[model samples]
Target: MMRALRALVRKDLTLFFEDRRAVVLSFAAPIAIGAFFGFLFSGGGGGNAKIPVRVADLDGSSVSRAIVAALEKDKALEVKSATSADEARELVRRGKATAAVILPKSFGEEAVNAFFRQTDKPDLLLLRDPSHTAEAGMLRGILTQHVMEVVSKEAFSGPAGLRSARQALRQVSEDKAMAPSDRKDLTVLLQSVVNLQEHSTSEKTEALGPQGGIGVPYDTKEEEVTAHAGETYNGYAHSFGGMALQFILMASIEFGMGILIERRTGIWKRLLAAPLHRSTLLLARGISGALISLAIFLVCMGFGMAVFGVRVQGSWPGFLLLAVAYALMASAFGLLLAALGRTPEATRGLAVFAVLILVMLGGAWVPAFIFPAWLQKATLLLPTRWAMDALDGVTWRGLGLASALPAVAILLGFTFVFALIAAWKFPSEEG
Candidate 1:
């Protein structure tokens, strides 16, 4: 068995070296993809840099002034003011602002009304580009968190203040609804006051400008909240490596198709007529395909590390064990593909499509966490997703062997199942 395996392995290596296409597919493609995507993911689209936030407060009223003050306080953000919502939107469109916050007139009144009525709505309009999801979400998170606290407080306490105001409306119009413009204006006024109140109490606090609109109540304390350094690593290395592993496995068709051609040309029958056992033949093919998968996997990882500075910080032994397990699963999957695809055309078409679909759903195309809750749960069944998660745990999170054990176990199970199916389906020469 050892001699047969060595001979088969040597033959595979020789044939693979002689074929430039095979060499390119197995080695060159991985390195190229790693470098290209490494740059792409690390470029402007990634969350590596801070984006500016523009503020436009039209109300100029005391409330708008306070909210503007709060805007100037966030350190993660750089604030600029625009004259109107249209101006703010244009700045966002021109990439001058990652996002813009507009405080319409009457913002304070709505806040005052909502506060008195115990309602929690504050009307601050956000203008942002749809393409910048991460930046938009981040800005939303920071602004919303601070704004809501101030707005909600008004919800609880502002009604009492409104009641105490000495000036009463000359007439209350009953039949007509409040204009949208008037409602927006009211909300802005209340929020500005709320913004002013919150920042005034903090360590870096400043008093609100008395009815005289000074620039928004600015605070220096918020600067401390945003001062972390270094490039952001969004855990893309493991994901890229996992994808490389999954696709390299598809190259098993190089061997799988080779098997069929050999059979048609009487190579298998001739080998069967000799002393070789079926187990030896099958094991040789599996090992050869697995070695190819491993080589491609390693090349991608090395390129990623050398070029992109990504490293596997976890246990080396644990990573190797997982790699080996994943390779076996990949090899088995290839054999399964060969067994199912009786013709080269069918194998190429069906295998490519199937692998693509699997990769897409497995979170190779997008992180599994981004999927809907149900889709995330569904991804558990895919071998690629598990491989991605395991690699992420090892390389990105530096997880220990104990934590990666479940992924290893599941991958090995998949290998066993695929191998068994291949063994059952793979035809012996005479039979």
Candidate 2:
């Protein structure tokens, strides 16, 4: 049985290697796809890294300059200075920039006066498309922070702090502690000075409830530095590499059914007459199927490295072990399919639907984290999940062999179970 399996596997390997298109589709296609998408994602889809933002300031004041400076502080944002509102809008519409900021002419003056009068706050106009939500939201945050800071500075320095000082002095004068008019005046004057010092330098003072106390300005230097540290690899390539490894495993179905075909064509009968046991023939085909899978896996990985800048930070031995285990499992599944289906049409149609569904649910198209709770739990029973998890461990998670042990073990278990099932229903000859 073992000898016959070896012979069958050897023959399959020979056929696969010799057929140029088979070699290309099984191996080259996945690698090419992995490389292309990897490059796209690693390079940020080849779009502009800096978010182009247009700024139109009718205020033409220092306040506008300060706001622009604050926006520029965020590395993700790029301020394109515009002289008019029309130009800014045109820039946005033409896709030259993401969004535009339009400051009203009386923005600063109204904000300052509003603070003095304790009235409504000034408003800054934001012009943007609905499609640019993230960039617009971020630009709005920076601008709002700047506006609040400006308003706070003006309020504390100009009149708000002054009013609080005088009110406190008036309370002290009315305390009537056996004081003459002239003496009360002196006390009020002294109290006013102390109040000014306390309000103006609020860090040394305690909170004054809902009225809000004056405070030193907050430092946003660290926030600006960490928000965008350096370059980022693309998501497109990473996803492509993972999907390629996952979907290519489906080739096992073809190889398995090819065995049944050879039997129908009398090839298997001739091979069986060559002093090869039936079990040996099956084992050889399994080994050959695994080799083809591993070959495809390696080529895809190589493409990722050469084109997409993906680095596998895990143990190479561990990765190879997982890959071989997954291949074996995929081969076993194909054999199972062949054992179940009595004919070629049945195998092809059923295998395609079943394999595609498993791959889709197994995080081949989307990450499993986004799946529902019950679906996530169900994935533990699926070999594709283990395969994807193992690959992710090597590529993204920086995990070694130890981390991939669960996945490898599960794949091996599946392979064993599948091969056993196939053996139970093993066909004596193709019908």
Candidate 3:
């Protein structure tokens, strides 16, 4: 019995190895996907990998320049320059830059004023992408820290510091936000500093802005902008689309299996021998497959909306257009599978493995934004990627009908390619 079991195991292994496509895809899927997931989960961005940001220095003063330089020196950030705040905003919108920091005109003067008075904050604007909110939070801290460090040193020792301190002393008593005791304390400190400067011009002291290290010297007004109709981003709205895609494609694979079974069982020979043209038969099958896949997607979406708070935040018509286009693409993909496959028995493992890899590359398992720029760009050629992007844009992104059209067009283009190849390869004559 042991010898027989060993022989059986060897036979199964040999059979599995005989199908080269199955072996390659079966093993390749895990390795390729695992590497990406490992990199993402391990906090594995190296020195070269840094968050990209745009800096707009409208002030162009020595102080503003120093702040920009400090941000450039930070290892965690990848900085680029924009000539204007409008240009910086365009960068964030285009996805060329992840975030933007705008230093308005006279920001340098206000920053110096802020160093002495806790209430006086320099005007700063931060335009951020909603998708990169977590990164934005970290970036906000980095920006605040660098601005304070650079501006504080400037406000402490320079001739301007004495002038600003004296100016602040006059305003302290009139400031309504300050408590009476706090106002008096600030008044005496400023008075002493002005007196010391006048009496001992040669004496100098190194100071890091406020004595107790006050909060950020700049007041930032942050705005989240993207091509969305919704005010906020909903993660599940896009995630459910990913899940629905997987389910729809799985159904398509089954459709291919059905075609293979019919071909193997002499159904094709009988059907072709009749007056019916092969193209008509193929078209009917695709239509049925498309309808089935669409049903599956709708059911999945229904559940997602009921349970997960997923939404059609964008135009309803646009969302439906994406879904229909994806369904047609899936049907064409099914036809391609049937044409490539020798038999249902031979194709099942390979087809399933291929689907998984496609889904992974499509960013169903992991978000594509986490991918390096090049990989994200490369994945755009894929129909799955196009579908996923449309899903994101129309759902969480709140994009309009116009935005969805391009992805729909791409999906139809892919469908045409898949159908053309399937028609060329599909066997009409019985073996």
Candidate 4:
């Protein structure tokens, strides 16, 4: 029994190695995909991947200017200037910036008053898209640190420091909210701050908090912005987009493979014997394949919507247009694959590999915005990328048909090219 088993294993190994294509694909596919994943994910980490942010300094005070400069100097932030809070927020909504940090009018004055005298904390609006929630947290932390530092320097060591110190001393004495113990502590701290001005102009003063407490000066009011003003983000919209695109394309590949199988089984020979031209036969296959893929795509999206509350938040017309366009493109892609494919055994592995690469670059697994700046721009060349964007635009982005028109046009263009090439290559007996 052992001898027979060894013989069987050896025969299998020999068969596998005899087909050089099989041998190469078995090993090369994994290696290639692994390397590609490593390259793609490398963009997510490291110092070079900075979050893009817009800073709107409505308060043109010296303190606000210093804070803006400090934020600009940070390695983790790519800062741009904005004229107003609305302008900065618009950038975030449009994806031009990851977050918007708006220093409102009187922000500097109010912050200083809050710290020295017990006024309401100054509000700094932080507007961010829902997908960028992680980056928003990072920005808030960064802003907090920078604001505290800037406020501390201004309140304790700037030309107005002595004045703020005197103001704090008087306010501490008159405050009724403070406990006796806390008031005593604040009195000593304030008096010492006042004495510093008489001794040395350059002396550093410890930052004061409202009511003599220790804290950041400004309050961050975060608003999670979605595609629409009232609508919440539906994560399923994006996931469905990527997953449907992938499976529909896979189904298209199956349709293409069917042609090759029919040829092998002599069904294609009988079809070729008919009076219909090759283009006519090929177009029928393409159309049927497109309809099938579109049906699959719609079924999946319907499941997502019915179960997960995913809505077409944008234009319904745009959503349908993109979905149909992608279905056609995917069918064409399948034809191209069939025209270029060898035997089923040889083509399946290579086709899957190509599909995986397309999906990876198309932001199927992760948002393309998370990639480094260059990779984000580079994905624009891919049809899968356009498909993903168009799907998102019509779903979560609340964009109209005009916004999706470009993607629809591109998908159709790719479809035309794929079909033209497949027809040219279809007549050849060679794979």
Candidate 5:
């Protein structure tokens, strides 16, 4: 039985490889598509692309200049100075800049006073392009953090410290038993506090905040936790996973066509005349198709990793399990297609349309997260979705073997159902 199955499998492989165009289309096309998408979505090595921003600093004060310097230091933004608010707005309107930050003429003075004396706050105007709202939001966050840091520094060093010092002097003045000279000294301290409160120089950093106090303006530290530690995200990983699943389904057409041709050409009758049982012959064909699909999938992924830097950060064993299950499902689907369709021509057209729909709904072209909530739930019913999910999980998601079990089970369940249907409905040579 094993020898007969091996011979049959070898025959199928020989016939498949004889068609050079089919081989190239099945493997090379998906690799090319994955590379294109990988480059497009990866943003060329996972770095944030800089958004152009215009800064309109009308105050020209040291504080305003510090803010401008901070904005320029951010790698995510390309900061350009604008002479006027009108010029900044024009840049945003012309699509040359994503957003414009405008500081009013009294911004520096107000900002300083607001921190030290609890005075009226300054408003910084942001002119953002409506189309680039996400970029504008990011810029807003950066600006907010910078403002908080500057204010926190001023609060401790400037008015906050002077206010505390003045209260201490006022308490000392409340002592009626103090000597005249001591009282005079207390008054001097009180008056100095008032002068510092009213006419404090922004340059007096040492005299700011409470004595011996270290103020941390804000928390700028970042902490990131990934499923796979030490593994940088590779955009090509997901792209290759998605594209491999899509092309594997598309390749099912060839399997269906091959079965149809075999039945039409009386090859099925010749195979039945051999010592092999009818079920055994069908099983051999299914195994051959599954092997071919698995080979194509691996080749595509291998090419992606070699040339495009795609990495499998998760369990390789789990990834192999998913590949095998999906290949079996693909084989079963092809057999079912052949069993259901009356003619090869009709089956080809229907298989193409079906595969394309499955690919789209399976999140082959886009991440499943982009799907509407209802659609995302609905896609759970699709075998392709599970296949894509399992591949993505084990690849870029860095999921373990345990995490991939459910997807493997679902794909195997689909394979069983498809195989049962094909076995029941497959055309007999006599018919």
Candidate 6:
């Protein structure tokens, strides 16, 4: 029985390889698609693409100039100076810029006073293109960070910082040894510090909601933890992972169609007339399909690494385990389709449609993060999601073997279930 199964598997493999078009389509198509997406997302070379921002500085004050200078310094922004707010707005409306920042008259004075907590915050107008909301949001965040930096430097500097300055000024105001004029000045300074502190506290409270949090309110620091030193994020890693999974499904469908073709041509009947057992025949087909899928996956990923810089940053062993498990699952799925499908043409069409739906819901074309929260939760039931996640974990996420085990386990479970269904429904010689 083992010899018969091995011979059947070898025959299938030989037939698959003889079709050069099939081999090329299974391997090359995925790599090509993945490279296109990688280049699109990473700007071809993984450099940051700057968002164009038009600034209309009507105030011409030192503060406004300083703000413009800060904007220019940001790597993410391409700052353009405009003579008037109208001009800046026109630029945004015409899609030349993402947003228009207008610094109104007296902005410098109002902004400084606001920083000292002695006046209302300046109402700078931010006119943004409706179509570029993401860019506008990013610009807003950058503007907020710049303002916070300026305020923190001015209000909390020198020997008289936020806490110490308020304390020192209060002590001077209460001292009878000081002149009335000096005491009055000290009192005013103390009030400014007190007001700023109170405002800051109130803002923090509002941001934290009713329940206070343990972490810092304003997160200015960012730290990247990588599995390997000097290793950076590769956009191709995600693109390739998704593309490979999608194309593997297509390959699986083709594998199913092969079975359908054999059945239509009476090849199954011829094989049954031989010494081969039904169970052995089914196992042979499953093994052949699994081997083909595994080879295609490895070739696609290899191309990704060599051409697009994708890497298995975590455990290579774990990554290999995931690849094998997913390939087996895909093979079993193909066999199940073969068992359930009625005719060759109909089976091919239905299998393709089902594969497309699986890919769409699996987050193979887009990041799962973009999905609605509920939909994201629901996608957890999909085998493709587990496969994609496992690939991501071992590649860009830099997760270890331990982290990939659950996904591998889930894929193997799916394989077992699919194989059982295929076995139960497999066409017999008697039928």
Which candidate tops TM-score?
4
- Candidate 1: list runs displaced more than 4 Å: 1-150, 153-231, 234-236
RMSD of candidates 1 onward, in order: 17.0, 19.1, 5.0, 3.5, 17.1, 17.7
lDDT of 6 at 401: 91
lDDT, residue 75, candidate 4: 85
Rank by TM-score (best first): 4, 3, 6, 1, 5, 2
Cα distance off (Å), candidate 2, residue 374 = 0.5
Q: TM-score for model 6?
A: 0.55
Q: Which wins on lDDT, candidate 4 or candidate 5?
A: 4
Error of 6 at 94 (Å): 42
Q: Model 5: per-residue lDDT, tens digit, 84-156?
A: 9778765664445767888878676566555532435677878765434466678878887676555544444
- Give lDDT tens digits, candidate 2, residues 314-407: 5677788877888888888877876776666456656666676678667677544334445556777898877776675555434567767888
Model 5, stretches more than 4 Å misplaced?
A: 1-225
Model 2 — TM-score against the truth? 0.49
Please tell me which predicted candidate would have the highest lDDT against the true structure.
4
Provide the TM-score for each candidate, comma-separated. 0.53, 0.49, 0.76, 0.88, 0.52, 0.55
User: Residue 28 of model 1: what lDDT?
Assistant: 48
How many clashes in each structure?
A: 22, 17, 0, 0, 4, 0
Estimate the lDDT of model 1: 0.61
In candidate 2, what residue range of length 10 has the lowest lDDT sum? 219-228
Which digits, one per residue and each the tens of the lDDT, describe model 1 over residues 237-320? 655676686677577666677776666677878877889887778778889888888887887887888887767766667678
lDDT, each prediction: 0.61, 0.63, 0.80, 0.80, 0.71, 0.71
- Could you tell which candidate, 4 or 5, scores higher by TM-score? 4
CA lDDT for candidate 6: 0.71
- Model 2 deviation from native, Cα RMSD in Å: 19.1
Clashes of 4: 0
